[model samples]
Target: MITEQAPGKLYIAGEYGVLEPDCPAILVAVNQFIRVSITKTNSAAGIIHSRQYSQDSIHWVRRGFKMVIDNRDNPFEYILAAISYTERFCLEQHVKMKLYDLHINSDLDSSDGKKYGLGSSAAVTVATVKAILRFYNVPFSNELVYKLSAISHYSVQGNGSAGDIAASVYGGWIAYQTFDKNWLKQELNHKTLSEVVSEAWPGLKIQLLTPPVGLNLMIGWSQQPASTSRLVDETNANKAALNGEYQQFIDFSRQCVLEMINGFENKDIHLIQKQIRVNRQLLRHFARINQIAIEIPRLSKLINIAESCGGAAKTSGAGNGDCGIVIADAQTDVTALEQEWRQNGIMPLDLHVHQSKIKQ
Candidate 1:
């Protein structure tokens, strides 16, 4: 049995701009993760199973915030895409064999009538590659693991910065620089990142607020898929249209990152709230890149509400439609505010960062 696990990530800074290659971003591994267990079987075709989805006969099972699937065409299209690429490296080294019965499980859920902002797709890919490595008993370094995982992530997410995968593999706070097409990993390193990781993460304190049942969380859904590929292609086509603007966004994002880093260093709740407010405004720049007709309203309101409660909040993922993140002081009145938000049809989730080594 080969068991591999990968941590889900929260992007503290530099998201939309990092969609373009060569834009640095900051991301950290959270307590949440996806775990995969591969049990080798002597069979012609591979069999994938998920314990989270309990109905064994059903190919797809949906429960409260859980979607589990067995076997279907393209059952794991994104994961297999990454596995195939990773296997290329293995094959080049003359490794050959076919193994079946790969079981996947995750903490990310989109089918429970809700979406969390954490990158489940990226987490799954990271877990898949790690599972493959474990199954092959390969003693690869974290750098190589990150390399293969990033390739898999881009295969599905497109033009990614690899920050999320880096956090999952490295298992800590990481100041990630974006990948430049012409630049190798060694050239674009930033020095302050080390200082931030060493000094900031150790001192930072956070509180995650989880709301009660039957409460509504404000979510903005375009009801349309925002293909990461289309976003990248659009930016590439209109280099004159958005390149400069995106660079500015990247700069602002980096500034916010620095601010948050300093806030952590100082444990200043006020400064953190201020930076989160700025981050939300900068998210608007993503609208043009995603080809949206207007800004998402419900999301905007929820963020305002959270801000009113002495915290700052923002969308968690590619936007268009997804969950949001709320950063508040440890002493914030989350229980009362959660009740208020629920009465107003908003759900609150208490998400916290993990300090221990993630289990497989």
Candidate 2:
């Protein structure tokens, strides 16, 4: 049996802007993870099981290099994509194929199955790819895993920046710039997966970052799930309507993220906190111009309480609802802040940054 896990992620800065190619974002992999375990099976068929899905198990078989799943209602789209892509790479490497039962479990969601917007789907995709590669005894690097997982995820979801995939594969804190999806799509039409993975993707960049010493990162869950894809689509639909304002947002967000990255490089906590406030204000302005509610009432309350307690806070992701992140000094009164958050129906999550064991 081979088991692999990928950590879930939360965006620290650069949300909507990261969707554009070359625009940067800051994200951190959290302690929560999605694990995929694969074991060889004697039978011709392989089964996938996950309690998070409505179906208990789905049986699948290999039919001339293609996976034919028996169930019509499939909730394992990302997993299936990851498996298919990894197997294709294995075929390229002349690796033998075998039937196996793949089991998945996640710590990224609440006990009641509520998503905390910790990028569970991305984590699952990365874990699935890693597990399958390990099963085939393939030598893989973190970059290889990230590229393969990003391809699989984008193939299934068809939208958004793949920063989550990078965070899952690399772990810890990272400054990420998205690759040009249109260019990738064009390359996929004629290029092999291995060839694409070997090439330098346009506008793609990833760098590991070290947080300042004595920095306190806090996460608060609003108990409501938000559809990131839906929110992104809605915002994009209004880009032409917002005209020059949209471009301005993209430019300002890029600058804000760059400044925050500098803060990390210099180990300046105050500068980081200041940029957090600037990014928050930038997002609010973007929300106002787009006429969307990125900062919901509960998220606003979460931020207000955190700021009052001497921390910098902002909505973590797409932000219609989900989590809000705070960066504060070590001396801040966390207990009092969390108490206020709880009073306002916010659940303070006990999450820490997850460092990857993979060699850089």
Candidate 3:
């Protein structure tokens, strides 16, 4: 059996702002992960299983580089894309490929089956890419895995900076600048997937960072699932109307990204806290200016509670409701904050920075 796992991530800074080309963001891998299990199969058939899907399994026949499914609803479309694209990479390198039974599971949810907005799809895509490459005995590096995951994920979603995908593939914390996703997607249309996979990705940037010493962190989930896609679409629709405000927001967001990297590099808590506060305020301003609820009642309460507890906190992802990040020293009484979170029906996750990249 060939098994690969990729961790989910938290956006430290530059959430909405990273969408712009060449803009940077910071992300950290969390302990939760999407795990894929694979075993070679006979009879030229491929089986893919995922509990999150409606049908839970895709029974398909593999003919050369194509996969044919008889079902109406395609649950493993992203997985299929990864396999097809990886096959392309192999074709260029002259590697052998075979059919396999793949089972994917994730630890990114509450015990009650609630998602914590941990970028499960990105993690799954990263894991699938690595697993497929391994099945073919193809030599791959972390950079190769990151590239394949980025392309495979973009092939499905079309949007996203893919900071989540990079965090999943490279692990630890990273300062990430996304490639031009639209440019890469255009290649999928103009050329074969194999040909595209063989070329280098233009404008991709990923740099790993070491966390500051003596830093304490906490994450609280509001138990609300936010569709990042919907949020980005709605926000993008208003970008033209709020051009001035958008530019201001992006500038400050880029500053926060730099400050975050500076803090990690210098091991300076003051810099980290300052950037956290400023970034939160900027997001609040953006929310009000654009008429989008980037921070909700519950998340606002969480931030307030963290501030009162001597920690700086902010909404992590596309906001509205998902999870928030809290930063403080080890001496702070997070016990009280956790209790308060539970009282408000928020779940405090026992999540920490996952240090390793994708593992087999």
Best by lDDT: 2
Q: Please list all clashing residue pairs in model 2, or write none if there are none.
A: none
Scored by TM-score, the top model is 2
**For every model shown, what is its TM-score relative to the native structure?**
0.73, 0.93, 0.89
Model 3, position 233, has a per-residue lDDT of: 70
Per-residue lDDT of 220-339 in model 3, one digit per residue for the tens?
998886667667877889999998889989888888888888998999887888898898998899888888888999899988888887888999989988899988887567889898
Candidate 1 TM-score over all chains jointly:
0.73
The TM-score measured for candidate 3 stands at: 0.89
Question: Which model, 2 or 3, shows the larger TM-score?
Answer: 2
Minimal lDDT window, size 10, model 3? 69-78
Model 2 lDDT at residue 309:
94
Residue 152: error of model 2 in Å? 0.6
Clashes of 2: 0
lDDT comparison, 2 vs 3, better candidate: 2
- Clash count of each predicted structure: 10, 0, 0
Tens-place lDDT digits, model 1, residues 1-360: 878887777765556656544444556677777888888787678877665444423245576789965232122665787678667656655677567577888785545423364666677777888788777766566656666776566555545566667777776555566554333323214422222212222111222222222222223222333333334455556656766676777788768766766665565656766776687777776565646522356566566666676556776555554455666665455566566666665565445554434332
